[model samples]
Target: MTPKHVQINKQIKLHFALLFVSCILATYLSGPSLSSMPLLQWLLTGLFFAGISVLPLLFFIPTVMAPNARNLSWLGFFLLAYLVWGVVKIFSPNGLIGGLLVCTFILTTFFYTVIWLRPLKKAAKARQQLEQD
Candidate 1:
């Protein structure tokens, strides 16, 4: 494969890794006290629903925004959403534990933002060099 293809693949792999790790960490930190359901069932259901909900935004939003600005704006939106969710959960019947889990999701979002931005910077630099050449 071409270097560009390889780079894109690498970036995609890194993104997936970030998503996976963040999900795991969020689950762990959120607490084990899920509503008496089977663990695999809960995990699969959540993953499926979240993927369905999030994937479209993930795929389309970057194309809508300028490439350099996309990562920052996306991260900001994600962080804000998570914070709002946390606040709502905190005040809801679920209370503090749910709030803490939402906070963990916020932290995970931050980590993903950092990882994503690093590669985005590198990709930008690579593009610049290609333009110069």
Candidate 2:
């Protein structure tokens, strides 16, 4: 693979790992504070959020290290949604840990957005070159 390809893969890997860690942290730290809910209910809610967290990985894993622009674009949208969600939840009474988790989520989303932009630009340039040819 090209260095660009390798770099994108590394970025994706880091972003994915960080996102997963943040999800787990959010689950463990904030899930129990569901306003006097039963323990089982809290656990179930956490597990459900955890499942949602891994949903994007379902797309990335199958794409291998060289996802096309369109696939990455879709993932971009997914991360954007997560970033917005984090921002909206930043003020919730979930404690410092939860706040930090949301910060991590926002950071990872921003990082991935940068990483994905490079390839998208390259793709656009390549298409332009083709059109010129």
| Cα deviation of 23, candidate 2, in Å | 1.1
The local distance difference test score of model 1 is 0.54
Per-candidate Cα RMSD to the true structure, in Å, reads 8.1, 3.7
Candidate 2 lDDT for residue 31:
58
TM-score of each: 0.37, 0.67
Return the top candidate by lDDT. Answer: 2
The pairs that clash in candidate 1 are none
Q: At residue 97, what lDDT does model 2 achieve? A: 72
Please write out the lDDT profile of model 2 over residues 1-133, one tens digit for every residue.
5787677677777666677777667656765666678888888878888778666656665543566667767776776777666665566666357657756765765566567678669878999999999
Most TM-score-accurate candidate: 2
Off by over 4 Å in 2: 33-45, 64-66, 119-123, 126-133
Candidate 1: which stretches are off by over 4 Å? Answer: 1-72, 119-133
